[model samples]
Target: MTATNLLPRNRRPADGPSPGSARTKRRRRPGLMLTLGLTGLGLLVVLAVVAPWIWGDRAEELGPSVHLGSSGEHWLGTDALGRDIFARTMVATRLTLELSALATLIASTVGITLGTLIWVSGPRIRAVGLRVIDVMISYPAVILALAIAAILDPGPKACVIAIGAAGSPSFARLTANLAASVAGRDFVGSARLLGVGPLRLMRRHILPNIAEPLLVLLSVSYAHTLMALSGLSFLGLGVQLPDYDWGQLLAGGLQSLYTNPVEAVGPAVAIVLAGLSASFVGDGLAAAANRSRRADAPAKATKPAEANAAAAVGTAPAVPDDAVLVVDDLRVLRKDGTALVDGVSFHIGAAEIVGVVGESGSGKSLTAMAAARLLPGGLHATARTAELRHPDSAALDLVAPGAENAETRRRLAVEIGIVYQDPSASFNPALKLGGQLTETLRVHLKASRREAREQAIEQLDFVRLTDPASRLRQYPHELSGGMRQRAMIAAALLTRPRLIIADEPTTALDVTVQAEVLRLLRAANERDGTAMLFISHDIAVVGDLCDRVLVMYAGRLVEELTAEDVREGRARHPYTQALLAATPRLDTAAAAPAESAGGPEASAGEPASAEPVRTLAAIPGRPPQPDERPPGCAFAPRCPQVLAACHDTPPPVHSPAPGLSVLCHLEQAGARTGETGTDKPLEAAR
Candidate 1:
C-alpha cells in the first residue's frame, strides 16, 4: 500500500502528533505491567528486608523432632535437620536478594564503562577488544561463573564476584550496540561539526539516548545474576551451606523430600516466584521502551534543507559564467588499498541541481561526502583539484590542510548546507526543534540568542512549517516525519550557504511529502540561486527534479543524462538502463520498452519482439565489493550486452548528446545512429 493510503482519512497534509507524546517514556511510570511489576518487586524487597525479624530469633534451633509435619506454632513444619522451615526460607530469600543485587551493580558499572570506551576507541583497540569480547560472549554464563568461582574463594563473596563477571559481557555487548547506533545518528555528526568533544558528546547525548535500552538490559542482567547465584549455591560454590541461601536450602531439603517434600517444594516455589517477578518487570519495561520509540516514530508506514545566495531569482540565469563547485578526479580509498570512490569528478553550476543516482553500495553517498569531505572515520579522500568558491568565502581546496578539522567545517557550513536521509536522526532528541535551528544560526551567523531565535522563526516559515513559532518549543519527537524534515532543511538554510549537499533527503518520506520536499528543494535552488548536489537512490525523483542525472555504478560514473533524457527513459548505459527498467511502473503491465531498458543499447542488434516483455526486467548480480571490482568494466559481469572486449578493457566515457555521457562499449562504438539527442542545449555541456 502507498504511504497516503496508510494515513488517517481525515489527516491534514501538514500535521503531527500532540506535543505531549514527545515526553520521554523514561519519566512516564504508568502501565499495568510496570505498576504490577513494581508492586511485586517492592513486595519482594520488603520481604527480603524484614525477613530477619519475621521468624523467631532462633532460626537454627531444633524444633521438637526431625521431619516434623506442620503443627501449631511450627508453620511450614521442620526440615530434615529439625530446623524451622519458615525461618530458613526467609533467611535464604534475604541472602539471595542481597548477593544478586550486588552482583548486578558490579556488572552494570563495569560493563557500561568498558562498552562505551570500546565503542569510541580507535580502530586498532576496538578490533582487539571486540575479538576478546566475542570470545567471552560465546562462553556459557554458567561455565563462566563456574570458572570464576573455581578461581576465587568459593562462598558468597566469590558468588557475587562470579555473577558480576559473568554478567558484564552481556551488558557490554548491549551497550556497544546502543553506542554504535547512537553514533550513526545525524545529530551526533552535527555535534561533531559544532566542535563538541568526544567525551562530552557521549556523556550528554549518547548515554541519555541509550538510557531506556540500558534500563531493560539491567533488568535482564538481574535475572542472570539471580540464576547464577542459585546455580552456584546448588553446586556448593555459593553462600556457605549452613548459612542457607536459596539453592543450598533447596538442596539440603531435597534429601528428605520422600519423607517431607514440603521443605524442598517451598524453596523451589520461592525461586520460581522471584524469577517470574524479574522477567515480568523486564518485559514490561521493554514493552514501554518500545512503545515510546514507536510513538516517537512518525506514523506513512511512518511518514517521513538549505541554502541562500541562494535567494534571488525571477528567471533562470542562462548558465552561470563559472561553476560554483568544481572537482577534478576525486578519489576515496582505505588504508588497506581498497578504493570505494574511484577517480570520480563532477561540477555544480550556481543554482543547478545535479542528481547522483545509484543502487546501494554504488558509492553515491561516498561521492557526495567528497564535496563536504566528511568521508567517515578512517577512509582518506583526495582530489587532484577540488575547489569551492562560495559567494561569501574565497575558494578553498576541499582536500587542503586541516580539511578534516574545524577550519574546513566552518567554510563548509558557510558555503554548503547538508541534508541527510533520516530527518528524525538529524535533530537531537533532547533539544527543542527551534533550539537546534537557532543554535545553527548562533554558531554560523554569530547571531545572539534572540537574533538566532528570530532568524530560526524566519527559516521555519521559509520551509512552510505549520505554526512555525510554536514548533520551536517542541522537541523533535513531537513533530511528524515531514515536519522534522522541513526543520532539517531550515537548519541547513540558516547560514544562507551558496550550495546544498543533500544525501537522499527524500528517501524516507512518502510520495506526497517527498514531492512536496522536492518542490521546496527546487525552489531553494532556483529562487535562492543555490546550487545543489542531490544524492538519491530514487530514479523517479531524479527524473522529475534534477537538471542533470549522474548514474554511478560500482564506484564509477557510468552515465550522465539530462532531465529530459531520464524522463524519456533514454539511459545509455546498461547499468542505468537496468536501473530504469527495474523500477516499477503503474501505467502499464508491459515492462519499459527496449529503448528504456538499455536505451538504444539493449536493442542495438535484436529487433523488438512483437510483444514487449511483460515481466519486470531485473539486472542480476549485486554490485561488486570495493576489493572485488572487475579489471575492466565492473558491470560487464552483469551486463546483458557483455562482450569479451567489455570484460578485457574498460569503456571510456562517450557523449551521445551534448550533455549526455555514457561508459559503455556499444554506446562508445556506434550506437548513436537514428537516436535523438538529449533536451539539454549543447552549450550546457560546455
Candidate 2:
C-alpha cells in the first residue's frame, strides 16, 4: 500500500502514446451552455441600452382612462394620474436600470482599479488606502447620496456619483485583496522571471484570474446601488417629480395608495424585476467563471500518453564543449541567514538538459532560479557566480553580485526563459492569450504589433495548440489546463531564448499533457539547441527528461550521475537510492484491490501478495530545520550511513569519475583508502 509496493518487479520502462495525440483524442471542446449564456447576456445588454427609444412618447400619454387590471387597450391598467401604465412602467424601468447600471459600472471600475493598484503598491500605501476606504464605507450610502444631492442639484448624475462613491470603497477593498493574493501565486513569479514588467503582468496575468470575484462584487454592488438610488428618488432628492423615474412614480403612487394601490405596486414590481434580472445574470457569470477556474486545476493522475511522449523525446542532444550556463558555489540563504541552498555547482552546455532532483526543500528549484537571477522574495543568493553565454559577448556571469543591470537583466530575460509549475495562475485574466504572448515578442524582439501577433500565432503552433489563430483571441480562462501551459511555454519561446529554466513544468498537467510538454522541451533542446536546467522532485521525470542528474540534500549537492546511471541502478548516494526506490511504477498492479472487504489501505502492511506480506518502508522523521543544522554535516543525523567522524567534521566533495561527484564522509574515506571506483556507500547502488 506504500509507495515502494507500487513499483514493478522487473521495472521495465514504459512505452506509451504521445501526449499530443492523446490530448487530440481526449480534449473536451468547450460546451454549448457557455455560448448560449453569453448570447442571452448580450441580448439583455441590448435591451438595457435601447429600452428608452422603444417605449418613447407613449410613456407620457394618458391610457384609455381605464382603472386597474390587464386589458387590450390599457394593459396592466392606468395609474391614478391616468398615465399609460405599461408604457410609463417600461420607460421608468429603463431610466432606473440605466442610472443604476451606469452607477454600478462606474463604481466597479473605480473600485476594482483602486483595489488592484493598492494591492500592487507597497504595504504602507495599502494600509493608508484601506483605512481611507474604511472611513468612506462607514457612512450609510443613502445618507451620503442625500447629503450630496441636498448640496449639489437633485439629478440622476448627482445620485449616480454619490452612490458610486459610496460603493467604490467596498469594491476597491475586495479587488485589492484578491489581486494581492494572486500576485503571490507561482504563476506570477514565473511571469516576473519571464521579464514581464508590472503593468503588463497586471494586464495579462493578475486581472483575468480575479475577474470572477470582481464580477460577483459588481453585481451585488449594483443591486445595492439601485436600492440606494430608488430610496433617494423616493425622498424627492433624486431624479425630481416631473421625470418618470421609478422611485418618483413609487413616491407619487404612495399618496394615492388608499384609492389606487396599483400605482405604487406597478413601479415596485418593475424595480424588483430589474434587480432580479441583474442578479441572475451576475450569478450565472460567476458560476461559469468558477467552473472554468476549477477545470484548470492540476492533474492528479498520470496517463499512458505521458509515458509515450517521454519515450519519443527521451534521446538526449550532444553536449557542447563550451558551457552555456555555469553556476559555482551558489548559496541561497533565507531572510534569517539560514542556508537553503549551499555551495551548489553545475553547468548546462548548449543543447543540454541538466536535471536537478531531490526531496521537497532540497533546493533544486532555488538553484535553477539562482541561475536566472530569479530567487523568491525573502531569499538571497550569495557566494554565486552564474555565467551565461551571450551571442554578442563572451560568457556573462549572471550570479556575480550587482550584475543585474536593467539592460543586462532585460537581455537575459529575453534570451533565457523559464516555464513554471502552474501556468493558469501565471497569466492575466483581463488580457487575451494572444495579447499576452504578443507583448513578450514586442518587448523582447521589438517586433511591430502585426509582426508580434504573427509570432504569437507561430509560437502557439509550435506548442501544437489547435486553431492557433483563433486560439489567440481566447483568454487563459477559456483554455484547458494543458492548453494554458502550452500558451505559457509559447510565450516563453517567442523570444527565442538560448537557454530555458523549467521548474516543475508538468506538475500541473495531466500525464498525457505532461508527456507532450516534456517532448516539446526535448525537441526544443534537440532542434533549436536551447540549453535547459530542469528541476523536479520526481526522480522518474528527471530520468526521462534529463541528460545528467544532480542529486541535492539539505542544501548541498550529494551526487552527480548520468541519466543512464540512474536507470541502470548505479546511483551511489543513499538519498538518491531511496528516491529511486520510492518512485511509483505505472506498470505495477495495485496490491489493495479496487474495493476491499475491510477498507482502503491507508498504512504500510495491507496484503498485496503471498510473498510474506511485505510492508512498504517510509523514511521517518522530518528533515533538519535550517537553523538547527548539525555542525559536522547537515544530513548526517538522518543519513543511515553515519560514522563517528561524521559527527566531528563535514564531508568534502569527492570525485570518483570525470563527471561524477559526491559529498559524504564515507565516500571521502573510501577515496582515501584507494577504493574510489569500487566503493558503494550504505544501500545497494540505486
Give per-model TM-scores: 0.76, 0.69
Evaluate residue 341 in candidate 2 and report its C-alpha lDDT on the 0 to 100 scale: 77
The best candidate by lDDT is: 1
TM-score of 1: 0.76
Clashing pairs in 2: 16-308, 204-428, 205-427, 205-428, 208-429, 208-430
Candidate whose TM-score is highest: 1
- lDDT, candidate 2, 534-636, per-residue tens: 8887788887778999988777787888988876657766567666656655444353453343444443354564222122234445566545556666666
lDDT, candidate 2, equals 0.69
Q: Write candidate 1's Cα lDDT for 359-468 as tens digits.
A: 99888998877777666766777766678885555787887646556666667666778899997788889767766777656775678998888888888888899888
